[model samples]
Target chain A: MVAVYRISAIAVMVEVAIQSMSVVFGIAGQGKWIQEGGVLDKAVIEAREFVFPEVIGYLIHGLNGTILIPLTALILLVSSFFTKVPGAVKWASLVLLAVAVQITLGMSASGLPVLGALHGLNALLLLGAAFYAARLVRRSRTADQGDRLASRA
Target chain B: MGMGYAEHGGHGGQVAGGRSVTSLVADPRRPADVSVTLAAGKERFRLPSGRAFDGFTLNGGSPGPVIRATLGQLVEVRLVNGSVPDGITLHWHGVDVPNAADGVAGVTQDAVRIGEEHVYRFIADQAGTFWYHSHQMSHEQVRGGLLGALVVTPPEQPAETVDVVALVHLYDGVRTVNGNEGDVRVTVPPGKRARVRIVNTDNGPMSAWVGGASYRLVAVDGTDLNRPDPVRDTGVLVTAGGRADVEVTMPEDGSPVRVHLGGTTAVVLGSKSYDAPVVRPPATTLDLLSYGMRASLGFDPNRPDRRFDYDIGRRPGFLRGRPGLWWTVNGSIFPDVPMFVVNEGDVVRMRISNHSGDVHPMHLHGHHAVVLSRNGIPAAGSPWWVDSLNVADGESYEIAFVADNPGIWMDHCHNLPHAAEGLVAHLMYEGVTTPFMIGGTEGNEPE
Candidate 1:
């Protein structure tokens, strides 16, 4: 269970980074397309016209942020309940909270646009929280190994 | 082999032994009867209630001006592009105009670019509730308020029936009826019938119901229903890009009746200022398939000269090089989608099946089709004629129309977003070809 919790937390951390990079690449590609006189109107976006290859970055970002990262974070939360690591549940809860806030900001970014900055910042917060949860498992495992060795000696 | 625009042979250059799309016309030599020039521009305007919006407008206003014409009039509209950066074209929704006047950018004609003008001359053949909106970058342009109501009255006017147009649009996420955030009041004397033409220009189906009285759905997509029974406690679901004309007789008590539009805004009909009760939208929706008495469809759908399967599904794939869960037509993406070919006068039958987990209002430009069956169940009501038909998830609709109009026409999703998402196909006459190219120097992105 500790290993499952550790792996799920680490996956969330990795996925958050991927989501950030993919969305930024997507926006950069879109900006370049407009610079080349490719009108990036709602029609073009909805039609999902591939003005640039990096537009796939948006799909990757969206799918990972909405479905993959949140799903992995949820698994970490459930695994935290099964693990006996100290403060594992607290760190898992913080990661889940940051993910929830990040998704809310992302969904409203198109409408408000200003929320996009907060969305990016929340991704970093989520990454840090997930990393802390993953480290908790490692520290607990190391402590168990130390006790086992000491008692055997 | 790539499934991209490179595979499409419909753009630019004329096809051998085919009629040019520009050659299809409605009596070019005939003198104009009703001439109206609309200048399209990008404007920052505000509604009467002080709600501001920045978008493309016709004649400097969103929802433009109401264009009213008598039936059979030669409606000549000169569309001038003022300042819209991406250009614009007015597609007369639900008006089965001549193929040349269909106003589909890249299909029938090129986008009316800045400092350029295009003339659309068509006989107002069918009289009902219709509208015109920019077909270029339509998902953005239309949503940005580049549309208006077009009402065509029959030559012989009906007695004392007041006509009202309720064009529902969402601006910056604010739902408004005829560009008004709240109720738009119309004066209809007591016991007089008022025809409220509700146009759903949004991307989803909208439910409209009368609060103060039972109303009759007199028309659907500008086609009159045969013996439409009065409906109460039921709302009519107007598909995106479709219209419904509901006739309500004001009560003798002089109380205003609220025609609820999409449960948000409304058009109040009364003799004077009186706020009617805000009735909640009915739980039941009037099913057009069985709403009115049966009538002749004018043409037989049983014997089809051409049959096509428009199977709408979704799959993870690259559309125009962008990878996403894109909508497909007959298991193929845009530019690779089927080009339904038919000879003029061919009776065409189409089975539109949607498994895309979303509702798509399928619109066929320049033609009106009669719904024959849905999910294998035959339509038991009046011949439901529609230019825009809503096909929901898991639902299959069988529709048939005569290939009387000869030109290249767009058969695409009217939910402009879905249409942009690659749910677009083309219906072409055997010997007709378009000269316009999408996404080239013309920048014609007609969604």
Candidate 2:
């Protein structure tokens, strides 16, 4: 369960960093410099520039909501292992690796939309794997059925 | 015949072709002395011939006639203005004549008045598809049917079976094939080889195709004597001022074939009934002269003596304040004030700077150039060979080729209307035998 949490946190951080970097690079290419323009103006211009290529790249690479959500779920599942909640570790690790591969493919696609879409799909698979791992971890802990009842009381 | 004078709007008129008054006659074989008067106005004239052609004409017909001339032959054309509210002059498209015979209203020659006449005498030097129309306010005159094809056949062409000329005309943004609207149907007998020459005298985009068959693109914009390239699938795209010559062997007997055009899906065929087997020969490798290759037995690309950068730019609202003002080369309209001049054997490398806000297909009248680079970067090996190149806005392309054929060649945007507006210029070679007899009017001596 803890491992799942850690992986999910890492994925979120990576996504945010990539998105921010894309925004910055796009603005520079379009000739919108912060020193030359006001903050609001520059931000708006930069945001507009970042939209098309990035969205197209992400969609084509398949790195969308499906990949991210599944990855988060897997993180939650794996973290539950240490807490004696369920089969978290195994599923979380598998989901984490899948999501990681998806993200890597998306980054490496180099303007190809197909890889971006694949990246997005893998996130969903990661979430499913994480959920399954969590369920398994919880079941394993149930071996102490009597203790569970006492603790519940 | 005595010279009879008529006064109209403070202009003098003299009887020349046996007709005292300018009139639009129906006969194509009228006496050389019979002067026909044509007036350019907002009103329309119905054509006496051509099916479904009750078109608006400045003269008597839309796209009048084919002016025939042999290579190295000199012909005299007398232009008279009878009905125009303003003075006008005609420019012979792609003919390498003297500067004075260029017929530019304000630049080359003065506009012929309502009752006056201007005579142009020029020897047809370069052979290929050329056209003629009123250069003054060409947008309106060309639209009104003052344009026609001028075919100059080379004297050295080997004997061929059938000689056919297809003068393609366009009106109001539509191509009128064989006097009919839309794609034209051309019939070729089975097993027979034929030469197809196309001249685009329209103001819009155009492309040519043969349904279920492929053809070889031979010459472009009248630059012949070069090796040919065979094209498969979706025939050549000919912009407004461009021309293409293709030779194809007819299909087997009893097989139906048709010609297709871009933007429309139906096959265009003639109304004649045919019977025969449709047979196309097996594809074989054609020995074509590559852009950089020089061979004595095949077409050789011309070597350049100089090279320059030509930037195509467009300011918004250039056309009558229209927001979508399109394209320009070197910051000037076609036939700009200072034209490009070159001597024979000079290989010129022209870097095209495209900032026109739209894709412009640029074509040179007398030579095929090599595309050397794109956007300041060298092109990959074996770039697609073409005489006409479609350049996108904000992009830059470089083409280098030799200047072998002499005469004044026009380098302009292939868009017809744009060429009319000023997207044209000349390539001149020194010491060639020119067919133009300039200043040959009434008492002027030929230079």
Candidate 3:
């Protein structure tokens, strides 16, 4: 259970980082191709291909935060009761709270671009917190038992 | 000066020099109204201010000599390429030359090589302001001074006291008026009328105004304005690859009227001299949409047979291994952007919207269009005809035109750099095709 939680937490961090970079390209040029051309629409479409990929990026980021991160936090919470990992429960709660805040910011950014701008900035914060929490475990004898239980399940 | 219809049949196109040069031999018996010879080569010339720069010239001068003719006159031009390293072809901007004479580097003909010559024979059926420039790597060649003014006059000569062609270009960071880095003197007697034909050849629009007098806008992009009103303290913004003809009456006191071309270059008429005025745009611009007298259009622009919406935006993408912010049109990019398909005689309307936070001057080859509306407001003045239209960020323009010319024509941004950076597309007439491409082994980079 503990090993599965760490893997999901690492996946969440990687997704958040990719989302941050994709969002920047999605808004960089903003408007530069509306110039004169009879067949310009196709050229403009190709120029902005990075923008289309943004939706898929956001979906993955959403799934990582809403589904995977929560499942990781739940497993960590139940495992801490049996294990002697000090501050493990506190770290899991903070990770869950950070993921919730990150998702809210991501959802808010579509209607309010100013908030969208904030979403990118906040993603780095979420990634850093998740990275720290993912490695928070001491990897002692108790975590080994949790891992064995996780592998059996 | 009007030309009588002479049968131009069997003009031989001779192939020489193995896939590089295709020369057109004009029939000696075909009685052309005007014969002109141009030499395209490298030259080092000093501006009026004595600032020197190496540039590509059509006839050893920064702006190739003016080729003047009358409407309906057959103009024959022979282009001799004298070693420019790369190749070149003369594109008659604003003149609807026949497909063979259109001068696209690859589409119509190959680029003229070193020491090789090409002949361009076309009839100047329309009269107003137009220009000729090298279409082969035009973005660089034109800026390097490979362009010149081409004036086709009315059948009858005008009685104006003076006529001046002010082609605005930037050479080596210096603003130039007809190849002069500073004031160009145009002598016109007091009380006599003078006409100034201004061509904006830069990658952006230029503002021209009579700094100390009133002037009437006569024409734009080779189309005459109907009952143009004279206004002082105002200016006209000539888009990239666009032209504007303004007429000014000389002051009776012999005080020269300074026509400022974008703050740096100016035309000083008569004796009195004025410093180039700071080109501060007026709080309100000259609304070309409602400036001149409204005229009846032959067809209803409101009822277009085909309508296309082209919206420009930007995003990050990898173009040819270079990752950067690239432009988009209608949610797509180059090669995928709409290749507007049309047929001969189709009345097509395109609504262009720009949200890219920058200005783009749109240019269409083979035909000119009339502005129908801007931002949903119908044009209420003279039929605003344009081959190049300036579209600013956050603005939407509705333009319509009849597809009278049938061929595969390039339609792209007049801002050559933008066009090179994927803001380019083509207008394909049904049943017409091209054997040329952008990056072919036969050495063709049309932009």
* Highest TM-score model number: 1
lDDT of 2 by residue, B104-144 (tens): 55444556767788766666777776777676565556555
Error at A71, model 2, angstroms: 51
Per-residue lDDT tens digits of candidate 3, residues B1-447? 001111111222222232211222224466789988898887787654577878797777778888999998889999998968788889899987766677877777778889888888878888988999988888788878888999988977678647889987777545678878667887787888888999988887777777666889989999899999998777788888999999998878877788877765688877555442444445555789998999987888767667776678776676556665678877665645766766668788888888775678898887889998999998999999999998987789999989887766777888877877778766655556555555566576667
| Residue lDDT tens for model 1, B129-235 | 99999899998999899999999999898889998889888776566887887778899999999999989887877788888888999999999999999989998
State which candidate, 1 or 3, has the greater TM-score: 1
Best by DockQ: 1
Docking class of 1: incorrect
Tens-place lDDT digits, model 3, residues A1-153: 556556655766776666665455433323331221111221122222233333444455556555665565566556645445666666666766767677677655644579867766777776776677568653544577798999999
DockQ of each: 0.06, 0.01, 0.04
The best-first sequence of candidates by DockQ reads 1, 3, 2
Which 10 residues in a row give candidate 1 chain B its minimum summed lDDT?
B1-10
The lDDT, on a scale of 0 to 1, for candidate 3 is 0.73
TM-score of each: 0.79, 0.53, 0.71
- RMSD (CA, Å), each prediction: 10.1, 19.0, 11.5
Runs in model 3 deviating more than 4 A are: A1-153, B1-30, B271-281
